[model samples]
Target: MPVTDITTDPQSLTMTLTAEFPAPVERVWKAFTDPSQLERFWGPPGWPATFGDIDLTVGARVQYRMTSPRGERSSGSWEFLSIDEPRSFEVIDSFVTDDGEPLDGFPAMRMTFEFHETPEGARLVNTTYFDNADALEQVVAMGAIEGSRMAMAQLDAVLQDLREYAEGKGTRVELLDDTHVRITRLVNGPRELVWRAHHEPDLIRQWMLGPDGWEMTECVATTTVGESYRNSWAPVGDAEGEPFGFEGEVLLVDAPRRAVTTERMQGMPTETLNDLNLYEEDGATLVTVLIEYPDKETRDMILATGMADGMESSFQRLEREVLTAARP
Candidate 1:
């Protein structure tokens, strides 16, 4: 992660900022060009920008508004002057009224954005020029530096999410049927490494805990058909809450590719059918887990418990513990 650096030069009547993202140049470029992505981080932390109109073509106008915490609104417009894909672009930006009219006597800026490739990742440079030095000083007095820094920090978070998704460390839940949920992701390792991580109790204990403040106390797994497995977990400290555990019987097993099991939690009302399917693509492993509940109501209730978030935390750990360890 890189902190955004902002500098203003009185001699040149310009303010320049630079930030780095841990992603490919092309992906980083898309974050600026894509309206959805831009909307996620275009404003300061609390004031989120909403793009009402976006036209990236030369001479086209773009309009957006940012709402404050107190419900106050600020509008702005940008007219694109030039664009070179994945490299650079220039726009004329200014404050505007609700009716899309530029504010009288307010300073307008010519902004250029440049993307550069680096060994670590992508570097973005933003240069904003004012017609005169007085305008530059006026905007700085309005807290422009602090605001841009906060907005760039938000962009850092957005980049992290995009990278996690691309590496298959993100969880995706799909409703395959009325009673079944299919969660699939590309795990960043070979089939054998991922299989071992799941089967080995020590390795499973490393990443199976859903989120912070919880840990698996005991784990027992067997891959042979007809064998039974058990797991126990509880909060990390004090352990005052009810313990969570599950018992399951393996119904089908195929080395590193597939497995079917039936599991019941100690205090849960229903038993679930679990199927694990694995596929190899390039050097990575694709994992698909299907869990079937007794009825639609049960499935919906479980999904509403924010189960996907816990799975996301677990898989993110798996990427570090299993995939990164297996890297050649």
Candidate 2:
């Protein structure tokens, strides 16, 4: 299951649930906001919720109804208190009648949802706060914990489907030779813009960051045929550890067209050869990367380290921060 932890704080009358999903933050936010998508996984097993009157803005009210196998029905309403897009939201949840009237003496809780980015994908932390211990216990007695687990499991399935659908229409990575792996993507900007972003130190620093909290400490870009370049990065908050960095020698340069270099990281034992080719297609750029390792075993070992995911994330950052600005 994707849910990693669930805890109830009796003193605070709150329940906290943490779950991780192998999907981008934006997609997870969509699943929460889109009513059709929510209906797919919004209830426990054997009972599907039908959502209606969904208004996601602050102060808006949303309604949903769930039916049991024995023809029993339960309805609920949510009054959105705060909304922070693609990140977090707060809402007041309460039981309601079929006609949308509140149920007297029933349990009501304040729910908060927080979405954070992780290396693998995203993590969602949900907390429900009750007015008192009695209110919290009342919801637990109604099978809230088990129902939530089942609903989150259904969300995992939905995320898997989204991933499969994306894989069918995304960038292509392929093996070209015993020593070479080729990655190809159709970038949004023109060839010149893409080339500049790769060859300019200022541009590289903007998009070549490591994860969210790390920034490039130094960037030296030398794009000549025989010159060299070096780059280093460190975590933003702390400067105690040795910085991670890479240095490379340019072997071939064909301005805005193709470049080949030999690169070696500070800690990696094997030096690799990288060839970047940019082509202009329909006013956009098609970027192709060919990385040559020492041997097939060395290439497999590097691939096994899950380097592709980091590379993919860097590419996305480049598109979002550099290419978007370069777009004409």
Candidate 3:
């Protein structure tokens, strides 16, 4: 087990757990921040977790549900209170209803996660402060201690395999559910430059094109919430494809980190919610886009169109034609 010690202090109404891992602090941090890796071990043995789009910035909320083998589900939410990347973060942790309302009688707790470098590798110090002794006792009676131990134990495999998981994998797509899909790509560039590439028209036109013989005919990009942006592309020379375009209104924007938008093909009524997140490690950024469709039909229809393959092509061009040139 990764956990070396667990202690509770009724006087302070706090519980603390110390765990060590044989990995760098940054790698351990990513295991918690990335939803894909987090879901693998956030729940105990028979209970598996499913997380929503996780925004690690302060004031953002994250929701997740852990379902038991018997199909019972426990939902929770975390409101980020503060963040210091690769070092520590604090959150208001609460047992919540499916719609995210706090569950009655289950008081919320203040939780802090601290990461430190050790001679062997890295160490994680997790402390949770309750409002009172009763609150802390209630959580312990609910199997929090045993569950947490099992959950943290599972992190070892994740930290050990992250490199193998991402290395050499181009753009990849995963069906998250009936109506949601997640796409991820790792590019050799910084997060700021990658975010700019998506917003600045001049930079976008250089690499947003999916394949050769295509050119961006029009590009209108925006970062302000509620503002609409449009992008259209057409074939050049002897290229064999009709003109196509996409338009969307920005729902949220946190520069260099995350963005959310509503996207639709021009003249189409159906739309998808796109949540874009960027995380940088060792000078390279991992781009993750979670898309929510109106229904399974819409999700399946879009995937059938070779969308992932086209995205891979564009990402390759993005590295070769844009990011490389921007790097010093």
Model 3 per-residue lDDT tens digits across residues 35-116: 8788877987545577899898899999998865234679999899999999999999999999999999898999999999
TM-score of each: 0.51, 0.50, 0.60
Model 2, 1-328: lDDT tens digits are 7888888999988999999999999889888888767766787643567788577789999899876433367999889999999999999998999998989989878999999999989999999999999898889888888789867876764565533433324356677557878676666677898999899988998887746667898899987767888889887775344568888888867687667788888767679888776756456565767788889998898888656665666778888999887656
- Show the lowest summed lDDT stretch of 10 residues, model 2: 161-170
- Tens digit per residue, CA lDDT, model 1, 1-328: 2546899999999999999888888888888877766766687644567786566689998888876533467888889999998899999989999888998877989999999998989999999999998899998998889788767765654565533444644777877558767687777778888888888897899898887778898899998888999988898776455668888888766678667788888667588887776655456666767787899998898789778998888888998876787677
Better of 2 and 3 by TM-score: 3
- Quantify all predictions' global Cα lDDT against the true fold: 0.79, 0.79, 0.86
Candidate that would win on TM-score: 3
Best by lDDT: 3
Question: Which stretches of model 1 miss by more than 4 angstroms?
Answer: 161-328
TM-score of 2: 0.50
Which pairs of residues have clashing backbones in candidate 2? none
